[model samples]
Target: MTSDSVLARKPSGQSDGFEHHLSPTAAQALRSNPLSAKATSVLSASYADSDIRDALGLLDKRGIQNTAETRRQLRLAVQKEVIDSNGDIIREFGHVAEQLKRIGLTIASLSQGCEEMKKHISAAHQETAPVLQEASDLMKQKDQVEAKQQLLKAFNAHFIMSEEDIATLTSTAEPVDDTFFAVLARAKKIHNDCEILLGTENQQLGLEIMEQISKSLNRAFQKLYRWIQREFKSLNLENPQISSSIRRALRVLAERPSLFQNCLDFFAEAREHILSDAFYTALTGTSVGGEEDASVKPIELVAHDPLRYVGDMLAWIHSATVSEREALEVLFISEGDEIAKGIQAGRDSEPWNVDGGNDFDGLKALNELVDRDVTGVARVLRQRIGQVIQSHEETIMAYKIANLLNFYRITFSKLLGEDSVLLESLTTLEESALNQFTTLMRDHVAGLQGESQLAPPDLAPPDFLQEGFKQLTAIMKTYETSLTSADSREADFEPILTEAFDPFMEGCENIAKHLEAPARTIFSINCLLAAKNILAPFDFTSTRLSKIQDTVDKHTSTLVEYQYSFFRANSGLQPLLQALAPLSDTKEDLLSIRSLDAFRPEVLIQASQTLDDFLPLALMDAMENLKNLQSSKMARKITEEAADRFCGDFERVEEKLVASDDIWEQEADEETLASSQPLKSLFPRTSGEITVLLS
Candidate 1:
């Protein structure tokens, strides 16, 4: 190769000739010259003559090997060895189309099976739908029916009454026993159940049930009452055992208090019936079974023995009523409890529902029974009292009146504290009895005062006044026991004091005035002293006794002074004046026995002896009278006053006698002395007598 061809060629390491060859145009374009010797040389080296001829034979524009040039090329001898690759690919595509047709047929079969299954599921749902819906509805109804049945069973077990129990209770032939109580217990339980179960849900049903229960109990109780009345109609209520058994039964029955109240009401009615009969019997003056004929009388004749029938009636009534009342106490029929029940019932709008404490109906019945018995007995007593006072006005003894007053006082004192119409009646009776006693005393006093003027003062005190004083003292003694008791207040004594003092003291004054003044003084003083002794034992704080004492004292001091003045004038001077009067009356001083005294010598001696003995004897008699007096204080005063007056008067008289003797002695002459000899001789004996008397 020429250098130009060698230079135009790509570098030797650029590409392998088979995997990467340049196109002829690219090769030709990369070649620099067409006629260059380097190109010619490269062509000759790559293609031998045989290779050139074969490459010219292989060339065709459409790769076909024949032409005019193809004939030529054919003649040139083309090599013939051929392989068919497109025929095998066409066979494989035919097999794949057959497999695709088989898969499409399998999918069509699956879609047809799915449609059949869906139609079967729809048919099954249609067949089961009604059954399931009916089952759900039945279950709901079954639950409701079972719940209702259970409710009915519970109500019957707790609240319903048995036929046998009801029949036994309703049957009047059956005796009251535990069965009755069992019935009541069941009834109460049912009532409580109703409250718990139906209190708010069904109030009207609860009320109806309670009403039915109440009626049933009432019917049972009525039957029991009838049975009791028939069986025990003649039972002795006074018998302790029977009464106790009955009371015990009542208390047991009272456990069911609502039902028991009806029974108690029945008992009260029975008691009232018996009480009415008894009261009627007593009113008609009819004796009971065992009482004597003489033991009772009509009320008008009660004064004959007022305490007999009246006292018996009172005692019997008290015993009967008190026994019944005690039984009621066991049944809770107290006044306090009943009053509280009334208050509670009034406060609550639903009064029937409250406990109310006690049975108001039973209490009312009991109260009526008590009031009837008490009122009936009190009426009889008052009537008897009135009759006695009216019938025995003139004949009743003072002591009997006193005893009647005392009886009334004691009997009514127990009742005075009670606040009832019965107590009011008792109070009226008491006041009436007191008035009767007062009237009797007033009448007696008037009679005494009227008769006082007829009594002669020359005698002792009038008989009426004496008897009155005696009566007063006896009354004081009788009433002392009453006065000390708490029931007899100070006011009770006022009437007695008023009655006694005024008339008796007036009588005393009249007796005193009728006497001579000196004797009157002593007599009045003694009478007053005797009165003081009689009155000293009593309390007369507001009475006329004090006034009597004042009158007595007043007369006493006057008497003392009067006696003193009399003694002062007459004590030693009277006889001396008589002795001097005869001597002064004679022509000459006679000085004889007749002239010496008021009479002969023997009379003078008697007169002088009498005068000498009088003072001591009088003083001794006064002291003896003082010794007999009950009060030494009064006696002492009398003794002191009388003695002082007598002593002073005698002393003054003695002084006058002595001064007269001195006058006679100083005036005497010879003839006068001869005349005075007899007088002077008499003077020493007279003076001696006076001295001896004084001693």
Candidate 2:
């Protein structure tokens, strides 16, 4: 305690001498005649006069003394105790409020189903429903609105976009980071909104909506373009992620970007209103030729593959049909402007300039929307033409696609961007596209050729998948390196190879389905000759294994010295010697040459029978030719030695076989004969006579 406490108190601790007494709170209270501001003055200035000048002075002194501790914790203050209790309540209650908000939000989501939702929202209204329900409704609205809005926002977020953007681009632009769905959602909504808001006919409204959507989309895309310009630094590029993402995102948007078009289609569901042949039927005499309802109504087109109408549509495309063309035209173009324009220009001049002669001016109106108008549209249509060239269905769809593409390329020169350095580059494509299309048609005809429904003979599944995998890998490696093609003449396929295969695949539906063994192997051999029939750039048929062997043998003919040097003068035969070194024992061949039926590459043709027949006269001619070789004196000497060895080996084999004709029938091995004989009896001639005759 301060000296003041001991002097003023009744000597609380220093008793007797000081005559002071005070506890800590009392001491603190007595320490100052006026306490700290928050502690409050211990002695109130209430002398019943309502003001004591002396007391006021003391309070002023106390305030001046404690000015430095303005925010100190007044642990001993009566009001501090009460304030602390209320702060805890406020903190706890705020936490509880946040928890309740989360719970209310969750309950609202669960309430989207009408009856269940109605109860959830209302059941608690008597207690807390009004406030919670209001909050829940706002949250629901926010959820519904945000995703759609985000989609719209993201649509324009990318650096590249659909062919639609290209159709209208004033400057070069590409879609980059935009989300596919946002553009779609907005496009559909804007289309629907335009149709509802405008008084134009359905087709006209669709056109206007498309134009507006295209324009608005271009604007939205400006945001994305800017974003991309900021973010993307390259193209076709080292930046694989950006380039690939751009292509994929644009492709998705391209797949029928007119989302509301489906709705428009739905609204115009009546037979009279529909324009597609798929939606209408025609009758020629007693036969019905077009798509018709088996009933009087429109055919029920399930969202599923439209299976019921596909066959009819197929027949339609197969035939020349206008309705099918219309559908494709709609799909391929924003409005088929160039096609219509070309057709009109062609038609108006009496020569009929392009397309089908301008019956579709409606496309022109849409063409006006973009600054570039039809460039992107024309390019997209043109690009699909090459793909159409590969399509199995050369139906009207393919034809329309091809024709429109031709018109675009032939007229616009560079509809598909700078795809080539010279305009003639695409002109070059004219022959290729036509050829591809023709080949596709030919294949299709092959597939549909016999309609022979006979079940194919069951092939025994090859027993070894492991070996098959190896062979498959090998085939892919060789084929992957070079494309098969249109060269005029290298070699012809062996006639025997393919003769066995064509019949195998006559019942097979598609050639692609037959690439595995037993088909791959059987087909490879059988189709060997048929390769000449395949449409490749190659002028000659495929070379066969035997043919390759024949060629190799022919080329190596000058190696006579080398061949015999293998016997004695082996220096120049190092390459061959090296190659054959791994095959050490020529006599221990694993193959059997007993007959042509048992022949193999590793077999030593050790018999007069093989020498007499399948040994190929060419081989003997080679041996004879080697005997007369003038290239090397050493080679000539080596050949004489080899001939002697070859002849002697033959005689030795003949003598042994005769000697043991019945011996081999008993065991896999024969004991070495103590007394060996030459082919003296078989030859019936003396060695002196043979050597003399040779010399």
Candidate 3:
């Protein structure tokens, strides 16, 4: 090849290949060859100008044409330069060659096989075109015929489908969409129109048609219910489609004379399905009638049962009944009628038999299945409640008692009217609970009249009684809402308050009858007063208004007499006055004695003896009796009387001493002075024990 052609064929310097080791002769030949310069010039474009120029400068400095040894060295250098520049490209080329050898043959076979398969598939499509086209045309025609038949079925009244027939047709209908919705609507309308048209002309024919539709709807729901009972543990009754279906069925049946009976059956059956055992347990944590045992009564259980359980049950029934009632009202009954308002029960609304002239209850043999209204359910609850109260009796607590009454009250307000017997039942329950509480009060106070000693002034009945009062107070608040009479509020609380006050009165009576000694009678009366004071906040006075005044008057009189007698027995004043005889022959002068020699030693000895007899005993007795006194006023009064009497005696003795001192001073007599000193020494200071005792 020419030099330029060879350079282009192989990469610039790669035209001449390297060996494992370069021979000296080959290196000498490469150094003198003009191709090296040509190759370097060609590779100049691939490298930076500085690198190429430096390499060329080193070549020039070493001399291009040198000795054979130097030239060999130059040739070795050129060989290294060429190899380093092309090393990556050479290694990559070798790796690509190895990979191609390993997998290229298999890939070629795959590509050829794919091409062949594509050809065969195209040929198969061409072969089946006519047959597929014919099948498509046939399906289109069948669909058209089926659509026409559905349209005919939708409009034709005579084409009434049985439950089984509809089930078969629904399977063929496959996916339910707008078409099926339209079909159902049209079918519903056709049935309605036919019944109306026939009834206008031939009443018997219309009745037959109506009965047939009713049976069909009932049968359809019955089958659906059976399947659901078998298949599902729960169903979503809130689903709009399910609700719509029920309502539509109700409307169809309601237009006929048999509206009430049919709705009643449907409602009862639907409720039965919805109110499963699992559902009940999930809601109430107990079975339908609620948990009961001989030892543990349902009344207590009812108290503990969460209010939400009743509220939820009531809510579900109310919602279902209201929905069904609304649908029925759209067809048969006027909005204002008793039946529409659910005031007239379904069982009562049944028509009289033409043959017997006797009315039939709507459910016939299945009357128990039908719940007449929420009121009827509440009535059942009331019945159970009565049993509970009868069985539980005294075992029920005050809050529980109030709660039972409140449950009835709140429940009646939801579903019952003023005229409902359930409301009367509620009143009866309230009266029963109140009476029970009254009985409890009577039992609590029954022994009060037999008590030997009065209760301490601050002593109350018990915590239970207070709790009972609180519960009763709460119950009264509920009563005000339920009873709605001003007099009723008064009547209710007055009786309860009266019962509560009886205990205190009995305690008072026991005090009077049992305590006979003067001191104990005084003490007993004091205790009664303390109890009255304790209960002052409760307005017991008002409750006992007629009798309290008389009670107070009698007790007050007894109190005064006993206190006066007590003072006389304990007083030292009597003896002191007796000893200090009328010094100037007048009763008023008795207190005016002011001389040391005014009286005989017998008078002094008698006064001293009177004080010695009474003062210590009186002071010690006062100390001992301090706790028994009713009030601080009574104790202080006793102390003051003693202090006044003793101080007066001391003052008189001091006056006598001072007068004697004046006589001694005038006479300057030792005998007078000696008598005065002895007299002065004989009288004790008034400020000492008297002051301490008074204070």
Candidate 4:
């Protein structure tokens, strides 16, 4: 083949023989389309060189004014038949030439004015050019500043932590870097130097320094101690006795005053006391009471129970929050592009400050402040988390106490129908206890979730911020959109919930169908009630209103351009709906992000985050709502029958409940009977009237 017709192939098996490949002409065409070139060149022809008169001129002297006017003015006017009487007619005709000359001068002035307009256009464009340039420059500088700030923030977050502390902790902990170690050394030196300060009259600063050091230790020592403790504590030690080996470890700890060393000994001994359950809790707690056996007062706690319906609520909330964040990101993407587009966030000043103490420049500063809506989000989250924890704790306590009393009612059945009648009294007491417990749990969860009439209009979020503040205000609006499919779903027994499950609303009917009949009825009622009360007004106490208003106010402040109203009206609706779905059909919580399969992974993340605060409370509120539904007349009647039936079978199941080893017999054993001159203290049990069961 001729060289001109030769074909080529790459080493990796790429062949180049297709006519579809770009030729020189085609490549040139691909560089830019015809439309692009046409646009720029469209008006360029009008931008050619200007006429001479537009350049420069002497307006006063360099003019013929008007040729017709000059010629007319040079000539004299004559009138026929004006031969007598002082030539008055001749003088009138001559004045006409002078007026013509003035008209010619006016024409010249108009030409000059046109030329001046051209010069003005050029100057205007010239002035605007620099202003545009300066704006572009300022934006560029701001972008550079933003990049640097991001890098610094990233460094602090990821790098400074892990590299330095690697000597003690695992790889998963913070990546402490050289800077951290350097800082650590500095902290040590500062502490040593403070000793000298204390010796002098600088004791105030010295004391302050000491306090700061103590705080640092509190923060840092926890990690240090934990690592050492893990290392020193043996895994195989089955013995709890403080043997010689244990004493040696203790002795070494006492001699070595380092926090790490001390921790090693403490945890080593502690492992003996810590059961496998405790160890499990320490690692990943999913149970109540956790590692700390005793209750932490003024600090109610709730364990993370993966099995509870609330877990699903948490998962959903996590996903919804994540989605919200991402949507927000999309909303701000064009705006945030200012940074990547060469605009920087920096302090604006005619001259730099001594060390540039200020955060960001005018536009950049505003963007940074506004863009940190995440921080605001985080703050909201923290508050919500704290509130949710308290609410859950309160609810758990109320339920647990109720459950405990319920235990007593069933346990003391042997004496329930006896002559002593103590069991009856206990059961009555339990009924009151349960009633109170339900009330307390409901109230506490409501308060934590801010369900009750949130008060104080002043406390309410302004306009848009009320996004999450109110209970019903924040809860999901039923997707009455489901009504369109209700007829299709009515006859079929399927999950009605699946339609709401996916973002596109799929399989909801089928899922809803799977819910228990009671749950369905309760949910349907609530939904109907919710629909009827959609626009109802509430009058709440000022304090309650204020808190509810606060939740609302948070989201109100979030700026949503263009479709702001649409978003505000519908923001967080899906999450609320998901939470309420359980109340709707008693379907389990589709809580975590995994359930929202219709959305992209990133959107799921954002959704998860937004719901983070509200999910737990939403679940609690829903349960309470269900409880209320169950306590209705019909439901109560059903429950009473259930309880009666259970009591009727009490004798048949009596053997299953009694504690082994005759708890009564132990109290009345030989030791007691031998010493007894009929010992009254041990004989509290008059008979086998109320030998109770235990869990």
Report lDDT (CA) for all predictions: 0.56, 0.37, 0.49, 0.36
Tell me the spans in candidate 1 whose CA falls farther than 4 Å from its real position. Answer: 1-154, 168-174, 202-208, 214-235, 243-371, 395-409, 412-432, 452-459, 477-484, 487-489, 510-524, 533-551, 563-636, 642-695
Candidate 4 local Cα displacement, residue 461, angstroms: 99
Runs of candidate 2 exceeding 4 Å displacement:
1-407, 410-526, 532-676, 679-695
Q: How close is candidate 1 to the true structure, as a TM-score?
A: 0.52
Ranking by lDDT: 1, 3, 2, 4
- Whose TM-score is higher: candidate 1's or candidate 3's? 1
Selected candidate, larger lDDT, 2 vs 3: 3
lDDT of 1: 0.56
Residues 533-580 of candidate 1: C-alpha lDDT, one tens digit per residue: 777877643244576678777866775665445443334335545455
Question: In TM-score terms, which candidate is top?
Answer: 1
In model 1, what lDDT does residue 455 have? 33
Q: Where is the poorest 10-residue window by lDDT in model 1?
A: 676-685
lDDT of 2 by residue, 247-344 (tens): 33322322222322232232223211222322233211111344335544322232122222332332332232223223323433433344344334
Per-model TM-score, in order, reads 0.52, 0.18, 0.37, 0.13
- The worst-scoring run of ten residues by lDDT in candidate 3 lies at 361-370
lDDT of 3 by residue, 303-397 (tens): 45423334344344445444543433342333234332221222233345232244333222122332333345445545654555555445235
